[model samples]
Target chain A: MIPTIPQPRLLTAAYTAYVVTFFVFLALPLVVVAVFAFNDSQFPSLPWEGFTWGWFFGEERPVIGVFHERPILRAIGTSAFVAVCVSILSVGVGLSNAFLFNRYRFPGQGILYVFMLLPLVIPGIVLGISILVFSSRIANGAWDIAEWDIEALRPGLTLVILGQFSFIATISTLVIAARLQKFDRSLEEAALNLGASRLTAVRTVTLPYLAPAMIGAFVVAFLMSFENFNTTLMLVGSDAPLTIAMFDRLKEGSTPLLNAVSLLLMLGSSLLALVMIAFQRRG
Target chain B: MKAEARIGLILLLTPLLLWLSLLIVIPHIDMFLVSLRERVGVGEYRISPANYLTFLTEPLYLRTFARTAIMAMLATLITLLIAFPVSYYIAKMARGRTRSALFLLCLVPFWVSELVRTFGWMILLRETGLISTLLQWAGLADQPVEMLYNDAAIMVGLVYTSMLFMVVPLVTTLESLPDEVIEAGYDLGGTNVSVMREIVIPHATPGIVSGCIVVFMLSLGNYLTPTMLGGKDSLWFTELIYSQFIVRFNWELGAAFGFLLLLLSSLIVWGMLRLTGHTLERTMG
Candidate 1:
């Protein structure tokens, strides 16, 4: 665009080549996954056999694909449920914390804020293990107090949600708090001046102002919980998300069925991106 | 800070404070103590530093830790190298819808799960993968070649996984530089190398520091990427930490290793910030 700015011809050629190579590096692997999904070979790897839709549509007895796989479907269902619960819990907690920090301050609020965001700073693996240890200690103490014989306490779905929420809620709080920083309080004040209760003012004025951010935060929590593997893997006993399930399949060696799963995941995420982009354009 | 607001603050903050303390603060404290203990008998433990000592004494653990740290740093460096040009293009050259589209390109891949992304690499690079198939078709090879499970594979996975973290920050900082600065440098007879060294790199310091810090931490703490791409032979430190907890059920040793990782990563990131003459507040952004 700036003709006189003068990029040398050699440098220009090099830059163009670099750009193309980088794009190929970023994109080609993902494309390969989709292309190989339809290969008739049982393995996801190679030797291009003729295309078949069996990977996407097959019978239960055949066990050739993900379709009609109850275990995987149940895992999907569990993940959705956990993600929903995490979204609601995180948004509620995050909103309340954001309100506290933004509107009202108490002693040690600074320390409290740091502690809340620690989950984001610390490794997810560490967070998962810490929660597991803490819960087990509490459960063990309680069980001992009751003097009742029981199985040693181990992590469950509840602990998984708690582990994820330990950090994700903090992320929600940070996002909402950033939104809150710019939000004017005069609308709430005006409502209060007009003889409305504080609760009424918040419900009528503040909540509406915060609704978009709340939705954004909820989506963040849901996605993070849904895709979270490191933390959830430690806490999940018999249950698994798509990530954990996929990891299991990978460890035992993979097949084209898993490739079908990868294809579906790719399609699902692309759809999510398009929808978000469309939503942003509308806004 | 007002007495009249105390009741409201208490009411709003109690649940949050209780939850954080119970979940985060207490667990970290528990981990600290657990990391210091020795299991002497069944259902009995005492304060000892054997776990930490073991990490120091074991050559396998020590070598893995050193390798993991070196590889993480190397990955961070490569990511920075790859990201700088692309970030510069998006921030300075591209405009309007084109710029937005390019920026979106870097982001869209991240939304897919990391597991899926790593699987994508395996599909292309494994012995019977796309690459091998292509080579065989071209008569370059007699059979499929194994491309996965090596140092190069791990590096590829690491760089691919963390490149976005590097680019986004670099773009953010570079976009703020006025075009006139570069124009001024050129008018003063600055060549490309001189201009890049004296102006562009200096201008991009905060972004560079932040991006490197982030990429390093993410790569160092990663468990899934290395295990998936590097196969069984990969001795990533996180896998060591993971094996302690999940495989051996050794919480004491795992907690020690976990703390060591946290300590090492934080120390390295902080030292980097100091070396680059950036404050924690500025670089953490």
Candidate 2:
């Protein structure tokens, strides 16, 4: 076994070229979006006009920034609110489910585990329709009181959060469950042996270890809910998320304003990802 | 203590189970029932396979379904091929910081919405697109060539979007392989092709299977990329489902189509798992 052999020039060149080309392919589209966001031209593509901040900050007719736009701002607000609610709901359910699966050996656990993954397995469009119709007919009717107006029972932000949570929580469960798998049960046992109550033992020892994962899951779930379109599209009524708003505008015809929104979103996601990696590394 | 733990477990499991049964399981059962019935009279229906039969008999529905399946499969293969080298470079070839940076580079683009990503392609491949402009500048064409509203553009969009899903698994699996093993093959006078065939492929089969499965499912169920990039004429199967449910208000037919999609992808994935002898747990991630 020789430690070294000179690689053929052609093979090395081919491999290098292959890697570089793939990187460009992976990058060029998003880069195109960001670059075109600043183009003074109204078109999202083509011969570059001189740059302007019209899409972002200009107050004139076409230059009105997304920040100042009303519908777009409302859509952003709706998206953020729904995403936050979904994240919190998902993390709560997921942590409980994760605890149930990871800690105990229960009958039918296998069946429940498989059932949990069905949300991920089913198509988003199908899930959207399911939630939409189910809420409108069956679930809504069941929860509807004759004389009471329950704002939470409708197919708006509440339904959106519920729909997203059904699957996102399962994903969150998987993440937290993975973290839990590495835990030494004896730590909890040791706390118990030290005369701490069972609740206190879990609250102190196991919960601390699970905190990092729960936080990670929260961020991941929030981002997932924000980006989700197919399920959200059908489930949403009388209110639009950023994706639906952008989609409606795209159908009408796109402007650099959409690109500006995309640029901001891309930066936000990049920062979140960096923060996540840093947080995980530090933990 | 045991009784307490049992009560706690039941309490913990109740909400998720109730949630799934209400929102997921029952809805699907209802969808299944919807798929089984056709409108006999106003508000009247019977259990029959009329919807499924329509899917099988109608050439338009059948052709669209077949085409979407074939196209999605092709996109998965293309994504796998393109992502392999990038994953290998990051996992096997590159050193510490360079590897992380390259991995991050692969990831950062996906943070944008899928719609936005597809829109980027729209901007790039339109008649007056950057590529068309570049071609004219390089004297490769006389005028801006119309690149949009075509299958190739759709393929490009699908492949580009699915890159991350494919790369992550491949990199995860490849990362665990000791360099000494590859070096050993080289020392044994194994040529590149033989070594890769005997060593790399076998070791990477799980990652490859998982990646392919995920990409295939995602692309098949995807409604955005094909419609956006391929324009009105794409006739993607998901679009047909959309029209059935939303446009035509034919939930029975749409339910059938939706269930068929789920069944088809599941069957293909199941068959692949059996063929490759991979487990659901291992391939899922």
Candidate 3:
């Protein structure tokens, strides 16, 4: 390392101390969360209860582990289902956005490009509320005018997916577009020059090149959809996602079972994060 | 364009048009329209600005709104101060593996849901939690201290939630600074502080502005962190919006509050970009 000057010993020591403290502060809460997960107690707080797997595996009436908890399990399933739908939809729309922005120039393209970023700048809560208001208005109009009730437009999982897709598509677009910008046009041109049809050239050459980005965007989008709370909270009706369920339980009271669920979430998300990093490195 | 290419362009544009219109443009327009409608009777309504006027007249709402804005700005500043040195250390001082590892450490917490992170803080700062226990054990307090349910607790949670956003951008900007530039500054007899003030801050302005924008917006719109950490006393503006929609079931008022929040945040972000002489494309994109 090149020092601008001989760093004063005091400054260097102080910086070192600060860095250590900063990391400790970052890790402390997460550490406490994980530790209390296994603690053999009713509460998630201190007083070093002996470690037990009851929070995960206990069959007792009071210590109904997260696995055995019906609502929690159902919420997990709901979250997974929503995440899958959001990822697929986001990636599909994202691919279209990438092609639209990258492959052609059109009227209002600059304005459209800025407009595309509107979802990112807007708050998540407002996004959800807007969608909620708009869809329900449509639903009411449909019923009133045409005597046809549109169930999908009501506050439910479908609206949840639509709400998340509003912004996630922007992200997937950014991810895929970054990769698309680096593409060599001649590669597709060469294929076209070799008597291959345009569709064949794109399918054989361009789409394969974009595969890594699509996959990367898929994973990132899935993680985001799974962990989302603010927008999902507004859109969810009966089938609450894991986050909302956990939030409700949190408000009711503290329990080691909540810690157990938190530990599981941490581990699951850590695995996804590692997968994302690996994909980024490889791509 | 030729016929085939024209049709292909139409196909390409269809999804963008539909997605933006159906999900974003139309909905927001509908929200604006809804915000202006006042319910006159059970099933009757009229165009009015009563909802917006209510926001202006309610002292509690006004006070809460101001408090949220001030707290969010304070949190953003705190996040910047804490992240700068750590980012510098990771970007300039730390070696290869250590740098990546430290950066990864910063990112890992964010990978989990914000609920989990806030839950962790709740466990630590609640009256009967670890910090209070430690204080008692250390003879620092005679009774358990209620660290949660206060503005300071909310600030702590907000900063923790947004620290990675600040660090990632700062590190990206700092890493691009050539070492020779720093060496040159030293060669010209510049001290560390002066070199940092002139060279580093200028180079990092785009990153700083972008990071601040994101952090400020996040802190302002945050519901889970403030609600969970600060409890009923949080007085966060987002809570007002949430209750109007969820608890009170007043869609018109909620829509107005949502728009006000949108307007305020957009104004602040626009002002920051202008003050820093950075475009949103350059800073955010």
In model 3 chain B, which range of ten residues has the least summed lDDT? Answer: B276-285
Model 1 error, position A125 (Å): 0.9
Residue-level lDDT of model 2, residues A89-148, one tens digit each, is: 888888888888887788888877878876766778778777666665554456555555
Clashing pairs in 1: none
Model 1 per-residue lDDT tens digits across residues B12-36? 7887977788878889889888899
Model 2 TM-score?
0.96
Give each model's whole-structure lDDT.
0.83, 0.84, 0.90
lDDT, candidate 3, residue A246? 94
Question: Per-residue alpha-carbon lDDT of model 1 for A1-283, expressed as tens digits?
Answer: 1234877788877876887788788888778878777888778766677898888887754435677677777877888888899999999998888889888755777676666656656778888888888777878887889965344346778888888888888878877787788888888889999999988988988888877778778877887888888788778877777888889988998877887887887787678667655644553
Please name the candidate that would achieve the greatest lDDT relative to the true structure: 3
TM-score of chain B of each: 0.94, 0.97, 0.97
Model 2 residue pairs with clashes: A1-B187
DockQ of each: 0.55, 0.55, 0.72
Off by over 4 Å in 2: A1-5, A139-155
Better-scoring candidate (DockQ), 2 or 3:
3
lDDT value for model 3:
0.90
lDDT per residue for candidate 3 within B1-285, as digits (tens), equals 398888998998898999999999999899999999999999899999999899899998889989999999999999999999998898888878999999999888888889989999999999999999999999999999999999999999999999988999999999999988888888888888888898888988878998999999989889999899896766888899899999999999999988888888999999998998887766765
- Using Cα atoms with residue i matched to residue i, what is each candidate's TM-score against the true structure? 0.94, 0.96, 0.98
